[model samples]
Target: MSLDVTSPPVLSDVEELVPSRYAVRIGEIDVLVISDGVLPLPTKMLGHNVDQRARAAWLNDMFLPPDAFDWALNTVVVRNGRQTILIDTGLGMDPALNLPRAGQLVKRLKAAGIDLGSVTDVVLTHMHMDHVGGLIVDGVKEQLRPDLKIHVAVAEVKFWESPDFSRVDMPPGFPDALRAAAKHFRKEYESQLQLFDEEYEVVPGVIVTRTGGHTPGHSVVRVASGKDRLMFAGDAVFAVGFEHPEWHNGFEHDPEEAVRVRVRLLRELAETGALLAATHMPFPSVGHVAIEGDVFRWVPVFWDY
Candidate 1:
């Protein structure tokens, strides 16, 4: 065998790797962290008051690209013996905004052994495109379940439905997208719409609470069984949102109010030591935020591989 050094080395076949979808239990409720995909966000777009030099330095220190950051779009599924509840619908079937990297929620849900039609309820954290986009595909409703009920904050519905929404100047396609989503929500899911004004139980164990300012009705879903708890914070925080809770991002409808909501929530989460999952924190974006003096730090859940 030593004399066979003349033989060429063989190559192995290429392997395609995908991001892992994870499941963690919040007491008796089964929670599955599903991946929709990612959006490469510019750091500048993330914060209006973020110091350029400091942000760049932090990104460099973290070995991240100075110009861009990969924002993860994570959605959650909560299952009990009888009910299947979806936290947020990831970017749906829209072609214009559906980048190749995104629009994978349906496939990933199936991969996770969840039937599309088995989803009994969809809780829209807010009416943002990424959250509501997956509700409709190709101008037709992406029926998760024929009898599926849809829940949204009352303020959120009113915000997008108002004629004044059309009058307000927004980015070229943004207003149009909002109009389209509102139309679909009103027309297709009208009877299915369950509007809430404040914290209310969607079912016995799952609840929705308004966390506004990211939008008029931006909210979070809290699922608890026994003493275990997990909060699905939709766009409530980004990768750096917890670290720099004061920095205002462009995506927020009201930067000042957004900061206020974040600060109060961070403090409460810090005190309770409850687990958190955000849409743009990181894949399987589950963790806890620890309070350190005046600022909070992200403590990612350790993967026990």
Candidate 2:
């Protein structure tokens, strides 16, 4: 059940694409892992503070391209009794973004046999484009499930609303585009949007924890049913974190604080042996963290049939 960091799972030959949706159980609750698609991130954008040569060596060790890496997009649907909540919405199909292969969440959800109408709540981990883009369909910004109540962290909204947020230095028009997208979603669903702070139970069995660092109000959702615990760590740590927990990523707003959060939470997760699901790990990104010596390693869970 545990694999070392140096040796990861490998696929041989040209295997047919696996189902975009996968089902797993956390105690009595049913969790459906839905894929949106993959994002090709330039390697230079990662490990901002790490030496380029060292980073390249690490990437090569994983049998990955040293120039760019593929980040899998995954979202989780938790169903328990009458409550059906989504952890995060994936990137929506948008041709303008030029990500031709990255926005198939709608199709993936359907393949998972999830009735969009049955979803009563959407708990957002953050407001980044990839995480919130799926809220709008057909260029219309609204709740995916017409009657669903949307939940977001209170600090997340406050952070995005500040003028400073818009002034933050980013590539050319990225800041403007980010603010625009966030503004549209907030305005479109202002009526149904619910904001929360502190560790609170959002649903009967799901608890949302404020673990900000990547963004001002980034969070993690924990689902507890029976005696099992599954943590949905939204952008808290990527695959590279296993080998370099202190590596600062370019996407983070507060680099130092991000490292603190990643190291602390990853250590705790490893000690407690809890199941983890993240947005940017490989598809159906479910795994467990392991502490080897003084660093952390990722032990991806074998897909349950």
Candidate 3:
């Protein structure tokens, strides 16, 4: 019942017409944001608590289709000293969802010149299918180093035992799919998991902290090097979150707490002027959070071409 691990043939990242990767340097640390591709979902998934008209209007203002749109699936690779850490693996080969555009992380990593065995650590924000699916993809586990460590919050591992779905508002079969992915991912990678209670310092400047919102164990990774800082906020903040922090995303397991977590992270990013990157934002999803009175704004960094 887990994700269909049967992966399709690999496609070279060069064959794709559009760019699939972007690199950023955080002081002394090297960061790479790769596009796992995009997932198409209904606009209603953006905010199930509000009226459909409001959601539609917001999408229309952004020049997006009202009915459905593609949400970017972004994953990060961080390298500091001798350690190379992968933030989150994108959606990987979920045939049932018919999501062809996503699950491209494996091949893209190759194109980025990153060998799987070089990944010393993987810090997962949560166990959502889209985040951990790539680890279970066909031929992926065999390529990774046997000593690879996957750092996940202890709360995250416990929550999946009997995950609560009553609070989520996902599409027809998504809940089941998510549950299966989490279960299988845990079973397959149990021995390699380095469970942390609240916070873990993967390396000197890279830290993973549990924020617990979108899911009971949801966490965020903060990278600090010299005077530069970047936050891999996971699902704590979304693109629509800047203008409508109060609106509830359908995937939130605890919408009320999710709003609190989202606002808090946004405030920290805005006040400290740290760069922010999230999973479901635009391709690179690299930007800054700006505050005007009570409203928050997303200011994307100029592409470092």
Candidate 4:
């Protein structure tokens, strides 16, 4: 069943096409955030905190337009010793989503001198369409990595696999493909799926920590090599606004819990002085947390790429 490329799949025009840089080294581990494209969301999706008037003010201050928000889709690749692991697959070849190059992750992986078959594991923070879309290629029998172990949070697996989600009021104007994607998540990727509880170590230096609330079983991975530590914060913080550490994204399943987790994580990152590689902050989304006058800011690292 090859993914149809001619027609718009479900979530069209949301994935980006601009090619971006690919690799960063953190201590002994090498990290890469590959571009799966970008999504253009209405500025209102940012949040309701800013009224239309405040929205205009904020956009003007940023020197950006007040109408829409362009957010990047980043898929992380972590390498240690002979092991290569990917966290989250980007939007797949979903024509409805308007992503022609949705399944370029494998291509990018190859460009990085890595092979999909060599990947030991693929950890998903949650089962959201964007995050898991690349796991399986449309119309293709084999997944992006046929041999790799696929891991997801137990709670997240349960949520996506359950029929109850249909009862919840979805976001306004949610796409039909997204709804269908949620329904078929389990049926499509159950063969290699491995569910974990709160915390578990996938490798000696790579640990999966529970940071739910965003999606019931949302989790983050911490990579430690020697004295250096870095966290792959997947959708925990979307943009620079997360710099506040108290603000939560509107799409979060449980906003209150999301904020609590964000605060605690930011505090921990600050205290540990660990590097943070955000999936959606910006291109080459690697940075550090800095506390200033009771507010936290994301200090993006300078990449020579």
* TM-score of each candidate structure, all chains considered together: 0.88, 0.89, 0.95, 0.84
Q: Give each model's whole-structure lDDT.
A: 0.78, 0.80, 0.93, 0.72
Ranking by TM-score: 3, 2, 1, 4
lDDT of 2: 0.80
Candidate 2: tens digits of C-alpha lDDT, residues 14-58: 222677777878888998888888987778656878789988988
- Model 4 CA lDDT for position 183: 59
As for TM-score, the candidate ahead, 1 or 3, is 3
Model 1, residue 300: displacement in angstroms?
Answer: 0.8
Residue 68 CA displacement from its true place in model 2, Å: 1.5
Give the number of the best model, judged by lDDT.
3
lDDT of 2 at 232: 90
- Model 1 agreement with the true structure over 1-305: per-residue lDDT tens digits: 47767765663332116654888888888989888888666677567576799788778777888887777888999998788988887877556544677767877776777887888888999987778767675533564566888889998888777634422334346556666766775776788888899887888889999888788888999888999888888987877776788877767777888889888878888999889898988889889989889878989999745
> Between which residue pairs do clashes occur in model 2?
none
RMSD, each candidate, Å? 4.6, 6.7, 6.8, 7.4
TM-score of 4: 0.84
- lDDT value, candidate 4, whole model: 0.72
Assess candidate 1 and give its TM-score to the true structure: 0.88
